[model samples]
Target: MPEKTTAENIFGSIVETLAESGSKQKSVSFFGEEKSNPVASQFNRLFGRQKPVYNLLGGGKSADVLLWRNKKVSASFLTGATAIWVLFEWLEYHCLTLVFFALVLGMLAQFIWSNASGLFSSGRSQTKVPRLVLPEEIFVNIAITISAEVNRALSFLQDVASGGNIKQLLVVLASLWAAAVLGSWFSFLTVLYVGIVAAHTLPVFYERYEDQVDSFVYKVLQQIQDNYRKLDDGVLSKIPKGKLKGKKFE
Candidate 1:
């Protein structure tokens, strides 16, 4: 090989220095190894990071574009949904199936309209293809999270094998089984939506007519208490009580 010249020596030294610096630098990742205590840092110590709520993406291409329309749309959707739910409940109607059917019918109608006219205001809907919403990394991350959940579930089974509370374990298993069976048919989402509706309306209604609601509740409670007292005297009184004189953990 030919002798290394002065310029070649300088270039080689610069490359070596860059490689050393790059190796020592911390990697920039979506998630870091550092455990963030969100409850303590962000929430408990509000303004700890001193971040501005507005203009977070200040230096981006979409800088100064607040997208207030998105926020307004969300607020409108929530308000409209709540009003509809209240009206439907008052009318004694189940709207879950209706909502699902309406969505399907609406999409089909739009597709037919697009095919016939091909003049959608947003774009030519008939010509446009459905785009992927998430990045490839997002799908990989979701799969990893699901695998972690499955691992934890399997770990619970391992604990059950290692002489865990059989009664408690069995009860939990039974509850999960029943939930899965019901969820398969009626759907957990439908249950959650109904629960939300009940929460929004029932408490307000009860508080508005507190006296009447409480009187009805009290009568039902009185009947329950009488039955409970009878059962306690007949059955529970005959059951042997556990000793509480131990100093050690159960």
Candidate 2:
């Protein structure tokens, strides 16, 4: 019971961490406020609200090198394994048509959700739902769903990590689902694999860029401070100390 509780806590922490990471990504748009630097402003204008994860892929062959270095091979191997598992299980289910139909339905649902969420517009809209509510509510719901799934995935990983009664069969089943729904080839699985691999690799790239941003902002602040200091010492020093026409000097 104690072990189980400990495991649950760890799992919860992982979920919270993933959610926080995702939320941080979501906040890139907010960082583009009027007072923010020009680069951030430009970035916000260019990407609008949704910032792509690959934006972290700093640049060039180095990024590619990092991806391959981190998780490309493992993700590919898992994908291939998942594909085989999916094929074997698909023979049992024989529900390709139903799956495709469901996929279309899901796509339609997503389209509706996206539209209703006002992700397509600014805060104001003449729709049934409140304009202010749309983006925040939808994003909140999405975040909850994502956090739940991530929690489940993290639990699975934790079990494997701790050498607990790891369910190979369940893993195989999940792999099959991944391959079937997401696809084994250039599909969801491929994209997911790329994303995970990129996530592991691209932070280094992003950190460097982040450091540059920090330095730039520091320089800007430093210049502003110097200007303020100069103005205080020179111009402000020359101001008359006596009472003015309409007001007494404090």
| Model 2 TM-score, all chains together | 0.19
Best by lDDT: 2
Best by TM-score: 1
Report the lDDT of model 2 for residue 82.
Answer: 59
Cα lDDT for residue 41, model 2?
42
Mark the regions of model 2 whose C-alpha exceeds 4 Å error after superposition: 33-177, 180-250
Query: What RMSD does model 1 have?
Result: 28.7
lDDT of each: 0.54, 0.56
Global CA lDDT of candidate 2, please? 0.56
Q: What digit string (tens of lDDT, one per residue) describes model 2 on residues 93-210?
A: 4457658978899778766876877765668762444233356888989999899999998886766657654576567568768767655455454466566656654554544344
Give a tens-digit lDDT track for model 1, residues 42-120.
Answer: 3332223244323343433232223222455534554766676655655555678778888899788767765756655
TM-score of each: 0.29, 0.19
